[model samples]
Target: MAAKRILIIDDEADVREIAKVSLEITKNWDVATAASGEEGVTLASTYHPDAILLDVMMPKVDGLATLVKLNENINTCKIPVILLTATIRLATQPAYVEAGAKAVLIKPFDPALLGGQIESVLGW
Candidate 1:
């Protein structure tokens, strides 16, 4: 099978690097990183990744806002998005789901299991 392509959008460089390495090493997936939501949205449209790992908090455009933009764009709307957040409250799940997030992954996740978690969430 072709390697799954994933785009990770996070303000933290370390997080993006960790996720890139984790996904690449564990699942042998094609991973791309964006330092901000704007870049992530641009890449999502052009790269047409299989899925997106989006951080919930950002300076200008937050994850929810970014998701909305992706959903608005014809090229990116179909791609599934999984939010990575430090704050995961039960009340927010419905909001995230309603905003088109496939799942919400808690922060400080185990890099070794990141690939499996994504696969499970995406049903890949």
Candidate 2:
């Protein structure tokens, strides 16, 4: 099997670094990082990652808006998106589901389990 390509969008530099290193080292996945939702959307359309790990809160465009923009683009509409939040219980949230997020993962996640969580949610 090929390495899974993942795009992580977050405003916090530390968060992005942590997730990027974690995913690359733990899962051997090709990971991309974007510091904002707009950048993430742009990257998604071109990079065409297998999945996107999007931050819920952002300055201009949030994850929900990014998801919508991604869905609107033909090149990126099919990629699965998973929302990341510092808060909890978004997995059961209607708005996130309605916004096209496949799942919601909490912050401070176990790096070792991140791949498993994504695989389980996406049926990878």
Best by TM-score: 1
**lDDT (10s digit) by residue, model 2, range 1-124:** 9999999999999989888898898889999999998899899988989999999888899888898998899999999999998876635478889889899898888888898898899998
TM-scores of all predicted structures:
0.98, 0.93
Off by over 4 Å in 2: 89-92
lDDT of 1 at 98: 98
Which number leads on lDDT?
A: 1
> lDDT (0-100) at residue 70 of candidate 2?
88
Name the runs in model 1 displaced over 4 angstroms: none
C-alpha lDDT score of every prediction, in listed order:
0.96, 0.90
Candidate 1 matches the true fold with a TM-score of 0.98
Candidate 1 C-alpha lDDT tens digits along 1-124: 9999999999999999999999999999999999999999999999999999999999999999999999999999999999999988998899999999999999999999999999998888
